[model samples]
Target: MSEKEQPRLASGLAQKVVDTIAPTIDRHVNIMNAHGIIIASSDAARIGTLHEGSVEAIRRNQIIRVAQADDTAGTQPGVNLPLILNERLCGAVGVTGAPHEVEPLADLIALTVQLLFTQEREHSRSARRAAEARDIISALLAGHVAADVIERTLDAHGLRAPLQLELWLPRSEQDPLLEQPALDGARTCWVGLFGAHWRLRKASDEPAADAPNANDRYLIGPAAEDAGELLAQAEAMRTLAGRPAMLPRRELEGIWNQDIAVAVARTPARSLKYLAARAQVLNQEQARTLLVVAAASSMSEAAESLHIHRNTLVQRLERIGQVTGADIRQAAESLRLQHAVYARIALDELQVF
Candidate 1:
């Protein structure tokens, strides 16, 4: 690993390594710091003393074997190997036994130590990046972070621009997506919790956006181009929850129109409630008639779609007006009346105005 990313081989970590491998082998194990002093040993009495074989192995950056006749003070006849990670020498490990018998065990122990160190480094890096991503997302939503600042931060973290964000509400607490690992440089997307909802941000070109499936667990918001747009979409989705009539149908998508109808999506809840209340008094037949009339080019065309006689459709419209307190025939009131109908279909009656 690079110097900045290298993990320290503290006494605790050294002791852990000795404890793990010593049990699997009959030989005594010793983990030494880069300075050649034993930091951890299966034989605790040898701690803090220099191992001659370990010093030689570290100096040469290779395995060194001390024979029975050649063994010196503060050392035993054993095999020692240098611990190298990402081309950098970190420390050494020594196994006490005949040189030939302990060489293989020493090699295995060295590899294990390097793997543990590598894992620790990666875990640290992932945590640091996650914190950075949360901060960037929070600042962007708050409007405190500039576009240039976002661009620079993303570049530094290996994330690209021209990103699209999706908002999703989990249908249950056991969602599998919640278990996904944190974002890293290798990933093109990141999932995070923002406020009371979850936001998934990914590269715009990663995949095509599809209409939400009726059986899906999440109620997804439209892909937003920026944090401001995302906020508005989130608001609309939350307000429309538990009222399926306001959402898009599987065969005919209507909710997607919010992309162009930004004003409707951003409508204040009080105004929406008032508009919705106008249609709340209508029965199912009257509500359906009003929706058809609002979408139809002419009253006759609406009658044709509903499979009802033209005169019958007119009578239904009159009844709808009487109950809704708004006339659908007036051009000026039609738009507001239609919005009111949509608001009515999308919001729950139990919700306070």
Candidate 2:
């Protein structure tokens, strides 16, 4: 279908692509958001339901594929396309047509996806700039920076703080549903993929305690940091923390350092709360530390949290350093240690417990 003659899909191009496939392909085809919203589908019924695998890719940023049929015969089976542009996942388009039949369209899909994702990337870049500006203005407005100066700075920059801005998404994962739904609820633009998974990034200006609060939840924020930044931002503070319980050894191996899907939420006033919230948003380790770190304001604190002696705490801190790549020798150093572990866990946002 030509661009002008295409059907307007709820998902736009995904619908167009899927519709185009209808002329040649025999099986189902779908284009979906990272959230599993069927942007378009050859079969109309596929639209609103969640595409579990796609959602997981958005969450985990991992490439995933499920077998459409037995693959012992060297068949490629169905492929869940990760609509990625510039290495960041945008959304996904799927073809139920066998891989061989669908291969030809890959280039076309890739080209269009690149174009679309270029636009999406610009959105993320803009959001980052906006967030950084807001952080500066927020810092200034409380007398640390000053409101009058804030106006002058904005005037000079030809911009204003997106007074109510933030980004958030669900915890990263391979499951269609987040282990914690509150995470998705926290995002500004909800994204799901065709075959991967769903991801949501929270808006920039949400009141604390106002994001998706289902209790027993997970959240990270501030789009400035990608996967690497989650740990890099730690700098040395162990935020607040705990250990994995009843988790499998294999699952536990990589769970301690995975970056969870996060959103940017603003505090009501640019005060200590905002600073605190920003720390949580900007430093993913602190976010995870609140959930995964070994408790310790000092050697004494660590000892109490772990039910051990201060010396033992030091020994354990050394061990934690060896195990999780966190250097917990000082208060400032604990954050890095804390964040490394925080990013590795895969969350299922839908769990009740």
Candidate 3:
């Protein structure tokens, strides 16, 4: 709708707005839907009639409107103008004058529509984001869910992963950086555990805010390879917990043995947690402790599997005993620690199962 149709329109407003804007340009204004149904027009005949074929600009919400020099845009030499609200496209305005006349009007119309749509779109989008954010938190915080299922749920909501994951822990939600040009280059996701957030993209696309509290790992990949790769990454994510951090294709490959990859596929629910927590743990020492707990109910065998010399393993065992108050020398204690680490594969959430 035009500004003239606003709820609190001024007296003599419709005619006045038409008079003021029409003279400022040389083309007639036409407002149409995607189906070419003309809702309103400055030209009398076009008011109730359709534009013959589809009105593509309306469908795309694009500002610039065009037609061939001879196409049915009425007597215009060629249609060139814009349908806009305040520097944004809201509706189309066509100019019959030369390029000089048409060009400026196109820009002005785009500008006008942009302004008109800005507040409305933003308000609507904000409410939508708030609602979706609640849902995202629900996904992360509530219930027992399989890894593939959570991944699929995210996909259903348009979040796909193995997204080039990165953690962003912001000091404040009110940061000005959120609206900067740089933020326009990625998608965001949040994790409250580490106070982290992430930015994702397939290739390079405009950065969008995270769907909500579901942050920390952003998926950036080539668009076409996204789904399958995300699944593989999810499996990797499951297996890599407690390992030293390595970017993909680093020393990390050999570290992820075939068995670990298999373990990842089999352990869906724990996978996301494990990988995320693994990244957070960040050092071989901590990881080794977790792995030692994982390998055996006996510290002696855990040490053997880890290939550490027995005395050194004893010292390491002592360190873990000091930290967890559980003697790895005891099978029950060792087993409990192992289960805790393994169960916490995706540590960002509370996993009872």
Candidate 4:
């Protein structure tokens, strides 16, 4: 079989074995590929040379002992043991010492190398499965891949159709999910997005309610039926976050009172800019006062919400109108100002301004 088709010792892996074992054992360690070429050795100069002892060990599928230096071509006084993985001989590991002195060490080294190879194989398999999941999710979200084709691919990978999409956008660029995938167990597959965003595709067999607990660093998007809808939910959440008239105080907010604000945010860029222009001039204090007034049922409630006296709130309202040229007292102007504030916030969050 071709080397790729058969289990063989990779040069990097062989080198890692040598490096790891060399420190613990005082004797030199060497790892040779199936062809008996030294791939890794504690003696750096000996690498890439032939080791006849290792070659004999592999050919006989057993250990071979060299009694003295130069007893075999490119070999020293040592013991060489064949490294077997899955009952197949893949390589040999040799330890440099008297034949009887290093025989036990060579055996231990062979066992360690075999175990490490098995572990590496498992890791490679898991990575391959995760990559398959990512591809399936990408195709599913594209919404043009044929259903049967998706189903066949899912079966091939032992994955089910994704039931829901979960998204997370970092509060800052330094979030860890940008560099590593979140460990949500085996059933969920994660895909990373361009803006340090991450989305999870939970297989239909997994429980839908098992989401990560709320945290300060990430703004979680509402769960949706697919990635596309999940992304839309994320966009809506961002728009709501940007609204000066609304405070995103809750971890998950319903879309009940947010339809108009979302629609206004999706409007043409020029219209959004025009609406945002008036509200953008308002400073932080003015914006906070406006938010309370728009959310409260009455001016007294707005004052209480702001923790200020009603007369003090009236003064702030007057200042706000002067800055924005829009009255907050009248219902029509209040509604217009709310939309304008939403547009303004969305623009800044999206960096579209």
Question: For this target, which candidate reaches the highest lDDT against the unseen true structure?
Answer: 4
The alpha-carbon lDDT assigned to residue 71 of candidate 4 equals: 34
Clashing pairs in 1: none
Q: What TM-score, computed on C-alpha atoms, does each candidate reach?
A: 0.69, 0.28, 0.32, 0.56
Residue 126's lDDT in candidate 2: 54
Per-residue lDDT tens digits of candidate 4, residues 36-124?
Answer: 99999998998898987888999998888878677335557888899887678878988988988889988888887888888897678
Distance (Å) between predicted and true CA of 139, model 1? 1.5
lDDT per model, in order?
A: 0.64, 0.42, 0.44, 0.65
Q: Residues 253-272, candidate 1: write the lDDT tens digits.
A: 32234432344445676777
Write the residue-wise lDDT of candidate 2 on 213-289 in tens digits: 33323323334222222222221111211112212122222223333211111112233233332123223323323
Candidates 3 and 4, the one with greater lDDT: 4
Candidate 3 vs. true structure, TM-score = 0.32
**Model 1: CA > 4 A from native:** 1-10, 44-49, 69-72, 182-202, 205-254, 259-271, 281-338, 350-353
TM-score of predicted structure 1: 0.69
Residue lDDT tens for model 3, 63-141? 3433345445444442433254433333444444555546676566535544545655556555554455345434443
User: Given candidate 2, what's the lDDT at residue 167?
Assistant: 22
Off-target runs (Cα >4 Å) in candidate 4 are 1-6, 19-28, 42-52, 59-77, 85-88, 111-159, 172-192, 203-262, 273-341, 344-353
Indicate the worst ten consecutive residues by lDDT in candidate 2. Answer: 234-243
lDDT of 1 at 328: 72
Clashes of 3: 37
